[model samples]
Target: MKTETQTTGEQKGFYKLSSLQRIGFGSGDLAQNLIYQTVSMYLLIFYTNVFGISATAAGIMFLVVRVIDVIWDPIVGAFVDKKNPKMGKYRSYLILGGIPLTGFAILCFWNGFSGSLLYAYITYVGLSMIYTLINVPYGALNASLTRDTDEVTKLTSTRMFMANMGGLAVGYGVPILVQYLSPNGKINSPESAQAWFITMTLYAIAGLLLLVFCYTQTKERVVMDVKETENVKVSDLWTAFKHNGPLRILAFFFITAFAMMAIGNAAGSYYMIYNVQAPEMLPYFMALGSLPAFIFMPLVPAIKRAIGKKQLFYVFLTIAILGMIMLYIISVIPALRSQVWLVLVAQFIKSTGIIVATGYMWALVPEVISYGEHATGKRISGIVNALTGIFYKAGMALGGVVPGLVLAYVGFDKDNTITQSAFAEQGILWLVVVIPAILLLVAMFIISKYELDDAVIDKINHEIESRHKN
Candidate 1:
């Protein structure tokens, strides 16, 4: 068991994170949310409206990109872990990969080659790969920062708080901003591409600036240092996965949680535009989704202290499920067609639960890494982070592919300015409501299987530090 003195030190270190440092550490996530939400929320619409691709073709593209991820993500993970450069093993990638990611992101939103499949494929694929390069290392960078549990929580809360701030920019602000830029007030190809292009360039550039800020304010505290003479192998990945039970649990949780968030977010742009009959209100609706984080985030430590993480996840995930079901019912019933406030309220409720549940889980990565070290006598934070990255990206893939495929199958037309067919509306509802609800239910069950509580993790951390001291 950790002594009060050690725990206090951890708490102090966490509280000691300067605002600049907190913001810097948080910027990696901020950059990711900006780029990712842009892709997830608008890419399909961009394909249909601006580029003249069928919804089905876009959906197929979503799956292809994700399949490509399985091959790309792990390879990036191995290379980074093996090299362990001195400038900062994981943090350096934010600048190294970030430059290209920024350029590719802008290209993705460009409409110069409108209606060209090859153009879309080249930009989107490059953007996705570049994002992977920046993101995997960024995820690993969090664990490298510190090993103190309470400090990790503080770092996570602060990081998530900044991330939600970015979410507000992407989810709430982007639509309104882009529309304002559009000459005709409609976000279709040819006329509107320049507006999107300018907006995304601004976003990408801002994200790179944030990455630089993150690099300056942050320091690597508990990293697994690789000597200059050592070489890392891919087999080490398998060995870590085979032995690290907590890593395994967290990896599955990443898949389910990220997938749920991704699918729900992707479907939301469609739902508000088509079902709710208020495309202009999307930023407000998405803003509400992230707003709850501000209200509930400060309360996480107290909540975790009271209920424990495992129990807290169960409660909040159920709340999310119930909220989704209510939203689905509200969307389907003709009587509630004009109840935009009701939809917003449901979004807030659902978001509150999700914000609390998922936001706190990132704190567990360090805990699992600690557990792996205690169990295996080797501290391989990069490998552990890579394992979790694979599953999380897999979830993100599902989020993209399922909604795109479902909308395509239902005969959604990108070119139409008016309402879609009844079947298409139903598909939109299922994407926003039913499918995401089912995924959230799966998340609740998978979370139930996680065996580490606070006490167990604290013990593991204590053991690892003690052995290192010896």
Candidate 2:
């Protein structure tokens, strides 16, 4: 009788997951976005407006945390690759690291020690570090699930869809929930601290539960065996980085893509509240960030097949730039300035491009991982993910630093609360539109350097499997 691995097609190293299995895997990303997206899109605003810190100080703290991540992610990545736990390689972290990750995520938003940079630093740092523990392994988990390129695409599409569902919740639901819960029915004020804390607690708990679901659903089918894993070392991360050309290009792409998303996301609340002068519309505005995912993500497989991957990127990326340009024009025109509908429209256009371009990029990670595996004869998914994590954090560093520094330079007053000065509003505009537009251009260039098309990656996967068969 055949074993389950063979019955499921895993013995050939190209497993096809069930729809339920795919959704379970996707839940991991959804779980992360619920917590991390809350942090990415709202934490800066929370620190400045609610937690009582200057934008400059918050920016510095963000940079410091990323610097720490540069050191921490590699160690976690290398350690994960080297060890195999009884729970499961890679999948075990969904629960093991998730418990603490949820705690710190909730605590990061709490105002028990309000205005204490020391408290902010401690909680935020803990949150970022613990996030890496879960994020790196979760990233590796994608590649471990299957080696079939089409299945990987399907899996990535499902992951982005669910991930954006979490984004929509955080983006739209957080503010609405926070507003409903706040004593004053305001999301970005000192008075809303309790609401922020409570909201985060709920989201974090939900995220932890989803991680458990992901843990139950996932099994690592295409990973290094015992002897190959034993040879894994921290030094191997650097070796892979130097040798893996596609990984290098993809890493740069991650920095640009994430920085663009982070900068725009970080500035969104400020843009809605201050620049647009409509705090009531904040939820709808932020929700647009993820709304495109539901429409466009499902079309990614078809889009990629129709246009080819690189062309799909170029077209969507150009569309994103167009949306940014439209936004800048609307903000500057006196008549359009007050047109909320126009603002929302431009945002939708911009988000559509961004959502498609960036959302589809996750699919490339598996390709680069396979590239490294073909070259080295070892599948160090953990280490590859760690490298990507470090660069991804670097992009986030830019996202965090640029907004705070720009806001500080423009004399943004956390105390003012009602309105920012014209200069500050313009700075917020730059963060929302100009800077992100520039980053997209850079991203287009970097992705052009990516060498692995579908044909190339398919060939690589086939050759590796053939060697195994031999």
> Best candidate, lDDT-wise?
2
- CA lDDT, every model vs. true structure: 0.79, 0.92
Worst 10 residues of 1 by lDDT: 1-10
TM-score of candidate 1 to 2 decimals: 0.94
In the range 153-195, model 2's lDDT, one tens digit per residue, is: 8999999999999999999999999999999888889999999
Estimate candidate 2's alpha-carbon lDDT, on a 0 to 1 scale.
0.92
Model 2 shows how many backbone clashes? 0
Candidate 2 collision pairs = none
Q: Which residue segments of model 2 deviate by more than 4 Å?
A: 1-4, 8-11
